[model samples]
Target: ATGGRYVPRAILMDLEPGTMDSVRAGPFGQLFRPDNFVFGQSGAGNNWAKGHYTEGAELIDSVLDVVRKEAEGCDCLQGFQMCHSLGGGTGSGMGTLLISKVREEYPDRIMETFSVIPSPKVSDTVVEPYNAVLSFHQLVENADECFLLDNEALYDICFRTLKLTTPTYGDLNHLVSAAMSGVTTCLRFPGQLNCDLRKIAVNLVPFPRLH
Candidate 1:
């Protein structure tokens, strides 16, 4: 959650560095910290411009550079897990960039991504859902599987929870917690898997691979 040193292989790379720090201090530290994932103007050569929507599209090569090196170095990170919002602006652009770069690094690694897209009436930002949806489809083509969280579908739940003023951060956190729980649960309880996922993810392992 809050580590100055070794970050867990699992971290969500969303939000700005400043905001991520606040999220860490806010008690959701374990899930939304910087060390766990990388994105958003972290380094100068991050292959992104300062603008919003363009940043994601700008960093495809940069993301892959980091991922390839990272996966090669760590045994725990055989596969890379990434996240981006399909909501608008940075999420889709950046998510697409990261995913494109990932597919290029076709070693033994598998790239898993989670994205949330904006609803039509959400605001002016909603206009790009078409492009986001398209990019999401392309990513699905390369990824093992793609999971989509639709904002329109979620609005009813948010409205029902008295979050009409705006969606509460707590609600968002719960959603993330649930998604993660679902994945782990699908695999079964700790140390108890419902299936043997032991097939050598040769791509995930640094090659020459050991599957």
Candidate 2:
């Protein structure tokens, strides 16, 4: 995943091979452990087919190894929460492929994703529409609660609210992290009604694929 441009490695300051005082100074640093990440040697070239069929297949085993290790350590494993973009090859194709593979092992577990959908106005490549739709099809079958994030909406927020002339991926990710933190707050803190993933899923998703 670090092969992709958007993944914020600094969030997990502890995972880095070399320590950075500036990154560790941040409030949300060291959120992830060193074993929580897997990286590919190369990118998927912004193509869905290349990601899912080629690159994803190559990395699937390694990714699953990490998942199995993490799952083993959990006493009461709830589910998985993934954050990726539907417009990019790695996030869209590889992301869906990985989720599907994980589903084969943990079929009953809930799978939720913060998926960044493609936008016509702000796209990274010419085939983003194709990538998004193709990835969406796989997600429809594999994921349970797919929280869609439209790039155009994020762009609008950056343009109008944040007053940014040219917004970078870091800016957009900050907004997304805020939303993600809100949704996952109940699980992380006390005194919340829906304090678990299963409860939130039951309350928010009444029907299959309604997300």
Candidate 3:
């Protein structure tokens, strides 16, 4: 039913320029044009500070330009839906930076973020806690709503609900994608309620930091 609206345009960002190629080769890559992608000099190597202070700042203009173009295309821009991992360098640091910029540029617009928090049981990096903490502060301060995805919970779901003895990263990602699809289904298709971003915010966000 299209939810009485058009599909929103997207802009993808990455810290490593080379990674864009692989992303473009993915199944749904056709949905994103080359011009809609922005990249930094290199990967953040799990360093939050480096990604935030260096790579993120360097690509801010390009990112904003893409956002501006996308916003212009919309009849009435609903909001931004940012999906990123809180434990990684680019996702944590650059995601925070982008959220801050979006808030500054579009103060009246609703900004919702889907942040993936690292699992404590199978954490690969020692500095994940620091990255998660700092990025969370930005999510709380800048984003109108933040949906947290815990890796541990996701893993358990894969192991138990899916009945997988050893679930791969792809399995966990599928769960995440499914969850996102469910949350966004009301907006993507006709629904009795919560069919718009603002309505979703009104229903979910009771306070500034509650979401």
* Prediction 3 global C-alpha lDDT: 0.86
**Candidate 2 residue lDDT tens string, 109-164:** 98889998888887779988899889878888988888889878998999999999
lDDT of 3 by residue, 1-211 (tens): 1445433377889888777877778877655656888987678989898778987789888999999988887798888999999898999998899899989999989898889898889798999999999998888899987888988998899888989999888898899889889888999898779988889988988876788
**Model 3: which ten-residue window has the lowest total lDDT?**
1-10
Which segments of candidate 1 are over 4 A away from where they belong? 1-6, 10-18, 28-62, 76-78, 121-124, 158-167, 186-211
Whole-model lDDT per candidate: 0.53, 0.77, 0.86
- Alpha-carbon RMSD to native, per candidate: 7.3, 6.5, 3.3
Instruction: Provide TM-scores for the models.
Output: 0.62, 0.81, 0.92
Worst 10 residues of 2 by lDDT: 9-18
Separately for all candidates shown, the number of backbone clashes (residues 3 or more apart, or on different chains) is: 9, 0, 0
Candidate 2 root-mean-square deviation in Å: 6.5
Candidate 3's displacement at residue 179, Å, is: 0.8
The Cα error of candidate 2 at residue 143, in Å, is: 0.9
In model 2, the runs with Cα more than 4 Å from the true position are 1-32, 163-166
lDDT of 1 by residue, 117-141 (tens): 5566654453565656656565655
Candidate closer to the true structure by lDDT (higher is better), 1 or 2? 2
Give candidate 3's TM-score: 0.92
